[model samples]
Target: MKILNPAMRIIFLLSVLAFGIQACTNNAKEETSLKMLQNKVDSLNLFVQKMKPGLGELMTNIQLHHEKLWFAGTGLNWKLADFEIGEIKETVDQAKEIETDRPETKSLTMLSEPINAINHDIENQDINQFKKDYGILTQTCNTCHTANHFEFNVITIPSAPTVSDQDFKTLQVR
Candidate 1:
């Protein structure tokens, strides 16, 4: 068996000690980086939690869009009707995402059929069909409200434009 001399033994021990120190330094750096990433994630989560809208707020937006849709359809403004329906669908989608914990969110699926029918009526540009489909949509909204124990919030066909500033009628280009 060959024995390492004194100088070689000291060199080997110092090399091992240096390697150990470098490994510890690398571990410390990794831990700091992980903690920084965790802090960023926590901050983003808090921001999103604060920005989330309540279910009632989303429903109120839907209600406004529903009224505007009625006016647009009755005025034979298919484009505007389509836009309103899109807005309603968007708000409903947002509700589904942000209000996942709410039981009422589960009833939102009931609106899909009626909404699709309304979109079909809009595409055909048939005011009569639009009115009928609009009625069905309103009824569906009320049905959802009833199922969610919010029966008092009944939705009905709008008798007049909710907003007077904007004309529901389509402007013809002369």
Candidate 2:
């Protein structure tokens, strides 16, 4: 067995040293790439975190969406006051406009045309007339939902509330 010459040993040592340096360089590059990627992800997360909407802004978004749904198109559901025949938009419109403290917007809308008609025919003392119109409005809401493929979302006319819409019955009657 002959010993390696000093020159060959030195070359072998230098080759091993070069490979060790290359491995360290590759590891450093991989770490740098991983840190850049992590930083980009953190930057995106911070941007999203800063972009959150305020409560009022969120509420406005929801309200506008609903308004679009109920008021956007010129469908039969938007016109005919008879909830039974079609159109519950009148109810929503009336409720949106009422200035009363009681938020009977649903009730006011549910009883809108019927209340007007009842007031007109008040002297008749026709319970049947009011009842019939009430049923019509209520049934119209249900029917509209059904026709629009939302049959599961049933809307019934709320029962008479303890809270009356009329504070002044005589004036209200007038």
User: What local distance difference test score does each model get?
Assistant: 0.88, 0.47
- What would the per-residue lDDT of candidate 1 be over residues 1-174, giving only the tens digit for each residue? 149888899998999999999999999999999999999999999998888888888988999999999888877878899999999999998898888889788778888999999899999998888888888888898888887788998989888877889888877621
TM-score of 2: 0.38
Task: Report the poorest 10 consecutive residues by lDDT, candidate 2.
Answer: 71-80
How well does each candidate superpose onto the true structure, as a TM-score? 0.90, 0.38
Can you list the residue pairs that collide in candidate 1? none
Candidate with top TM-score is 1
Give the per-residue lDDT digits (tens) of candidate 2, residues 62-154.
233322222111121222112322233333443355423334333434445644563333334344564565456457556645665658866
lDDT of 1 at 110: 87
List where candidate 2 sits over 4 angstroms from the true fold. 1-3, 52-56, 72-174
The CA lDDT at 57 in model 2 is 46
Best prediction by lDDT: 1
Off by over 4 Å in 1: 1-3, 172-174
Each candidate: RMSD: 2.2, 15.8
Global local distance difference test of model 2: 0.47
